[model samples]
Each structure stands twice: as C-alpha cells, then as structure tokens.
Target: MDIANQAALVTGGASGLGAATARRLAAAGANVAILDRDAAQAKRMAGEIDGLAYACDVADAASAEQAVAQAAAAQGPARILVNCAGIGPAARIVGREGPMPLADFEAVIRINLIGTFNLLRLAAAAMIATEPQGPDGERGVIINTASVAAYEGQIGQAAYAASKGGIVALTIQAARELAARGVRVMTIAPGIMATPMLLGLPEQVQQSLGDSVPFPKRLGHPQEYADLVVSILTNPLLNGETIRLDGALRMPPR
Candidate 1:
C-alpha cells in the first residue's frame, strides 16, 4: 500500500529502529504517530518529525486501546502498524542468583510477545473497517520485530528467545487469517543492530559485537531495518513470512 497521505502507528518510535521507521514513513508523506512508554523521548521525536506523540505501554490493553483511539482521532485509522516495542533482558532459567524468577520470564513475554499481539489485533481491526486502498483490496500492512535469539539463543537469553520465537510463529498464521481481509503480516528477526541498547556499551564491547557478524563485520544501522520496512510496506506480495536481517551471522552459543 502507498504510504503517502496514509496513517501509520509505530510502537517504540521514540528511539532506535522504530524511530528510524517513523522518520522514513513521515518522509514518505504518511501521517505518523509515535508510540512509546518514554513520553519525553516520544514527544521529542514526534516534534522533530512533525508527527503525533503518544505515551503508550503496549503491554497494557487499556493503554494500547486509548493510544490507538487517540491516534485514529488525529490521523484516521492507521493502515500501517509497526510493532517494534520490545525488551531483551538476558537471563538463564537458573542464574548466579539461583533460578530466575518466574516473574522475570513472564515480564519479557508480556512486553515482547503479548504486547505485539495486542497492537496487531487492535490495528488490524481498525484497518479492516477502512476501505481497500488498491486493486488488490489491500487495507493495511503490519511489520513486527523479532530477534535472532529466537533461533540461536545464547546462554542467558531464554526469556528473550522464547518471546521472539512466539513472534515468529505468529507471523504466518496471522497473515493467513488476515489475508481475506486485505491485511498483511510480516516479521523481521534482526541479528544485531546499532540500537541504543548496543550503543550504550563501551567502544571495545561494541566492536566485539560488530566483529561477530560474518561478512559485514559490523552492526546493522537502524536505517537498514527501516529500509526493509519500507520495502515490506510497498511490496504487495511480501507477506506471511519472517525475514532475517542478520548479516549471515548465526550467533555463537554463549
């Protein structure tokens, strides 16, 4: 679907990959809404991009519902929904502190997996109510962020990997269910990116991580991820699949 003049809601749009996607969509003439738990950062980013900023905790049903309503009220129902809000807390089932708290695992699942589904369901419902945009009867497109951990999780990534694996599984099935309604679902399993989480590390640490990549030997830029998102939104036939954005890096077992 053409992003021009259409509405888009990007969760975790305050920084990192989501921020890059929001800017790209805005540059493409879409009315964008930046959704994130960081109100200040969201507002700042929204101001810079000339878009709406919504403080939202995607993990909460009520919060997500209200944010979506507010966004729709501002720019009409969003036809493009990008689920980039997620947390990656590395922890083993049994850690140095003994067995990991069950709540810790649940927390990751709540934010990464359930939160993704919550926004997808709400956004798809809104998109379904809108008129088809093209000859293909396309109403909307959805892009979700998963992780390479889902496939090759390291030593302390059980919770993170499980949450992302769930996201990967949800992609094709959700796409099949939404196909009849002219909505598309796709997932991106990013290996390693120079996001805020990574940038915060020491330069040596960052370099070490970059060297882990097979060919590029560097972390992916947020813009790289954003570009793929643009491609996914424009390509009518790309749906119901999880695309890995890694640079041929399968990740080592930590």
Candidate 2:
C-alpha cells in the first residue's frame, strides 16, 4: 500500500530501530504516531518528525488500547502497525546464581510476545474497519520485530529467545488469519544491529561481534532495518514470513 497520507503507528518509537522506522514513514508522508514508555523521548522524536507522541506500555491492555485510540483520533485508524516495543534480558534457566526466577521469564514473555499480539489484534481490528486502499483490498500491514536470538540463542538468552521465537511463530499464523481481510503480517528478525545496547559495549568487543558476520562485516544500521520495513509496506506480496536481517551470522553459545 502507498504510505503517502496514510496513518501509521510505531511502538517503541522513542529509540533504536523503531525510531528509525518512524522517521522513514513520516518522511514518506504518513501521519506517524510514536508509542513508547519513554514519554519525553517519544515527544522529542515526534516533534522532529511532526508526528504524534503517545506514552504507552504495550504490555498493558488499557494502555495500548488508549494509545491506539488516541492515535486514530489524531490521524486516522492506522493502516500500518509496527510492533517494535520489546525487552532483551539475558538469563539462563539455571545458573551459578541459581535457577532463574519464574517472574523474570514471565516478564519477558509478557512484554515481547503478548505485547506484540495485543497491538496486532487492536490494530488489525481498526484496519479492517477502514475501507480498502489498493487493488488487493489492502486495509493495512502489520510489521513485527523479532531477533536472531530466536534462531541461535546464546547460553544466557533463554528468556529473550523464547519471546522472540513466539513472535516468529505468530507472524505466519497472523498473516494467514488476516489474509482474507486483506491485512498483511510480516516479521523482521534482526541480527546484531548497532543499537544502544550493542553500542554500549567496548569498541573492540563491538568490532569482534561485527567481524562474526560472514559478509557485510559490520553491525546493521537502524536505517537498513527501516528501509526493509518500507519495502514490506509497499510490496504487498511479501507477507506471512520472517525475514532474518543477520547477514548470515549464526551466533554461537556464549
């Protein structure tokens, strides 16, 4: 679907890949709404892009519902919903510190897996209510963010990997269910991107991680991920699959 003049909602748009996607969508003439727990950062980014900023905890039903409603009120029902709000807390089931707390694992699942489904359901419902835009009767597109950890998780990433893996599974099923309604669903499993978390590591460590990539030999730029999102939005045929953006690097156990 053409992005121009359409409404789009990007979760976790305050920073990292979500921020880049928000800017790209806005530049393409979409009315963008940034949803993030960081209200100040969301406001700042929204100002830069001339979009709306909504403080939202995507895991909470009430918060997400309110944010989505507010966004629709400001722009229109979002035809493009991007789920990028997630957490990455590394922990093993059992460690020298003892078995991981059940709450810790549940917390990751709540924010990453359930949160994604929450937004998808709410946004798809809104999209379905809107009239179709293109020949495909395409009411909307939903893009989800997963991680390569879902494929090759390191030793300490059980919780993080499980959450992301659930997202990957949800993508195809969602696409299938929403297909009849002309709403597309896709997932992007990012490799090691040059986000704040990786940037916080020492330069040498970061370089070593980059070197692990078979090609490109570098961490992915947020803009690169954003570019793919634009492609997914524009190309209606690219649905029901999780594309890995990892440059062919299969992570080893840490």
**For every model in order, what is the number of clashing pairs?**
0, 0
- The sequence of per-residue lDDT tens digits that candidate 2 reaches over residues 189-248 is 999999887999999999999999999999999999999999999999999999999899
TM-score of candidate 1 against the unseen true structure: 0.99
Q: Which 10 successive residues of model 2 have the least lDDT summed?
A: 128-137
The RMSD of every model to the true structure, in order and in angstroms, is 0.6, 0.7
Candidate 2 to native Cα RMSD, angstroms: 0.7
Q: Judge candidate 2 at residue 106 and give its lDDT.
A: 94
Model 2 error, position 104 (Å): 0.5
Model 1, runs deviating above 4 Å: none
lDDT of 2: 0.95
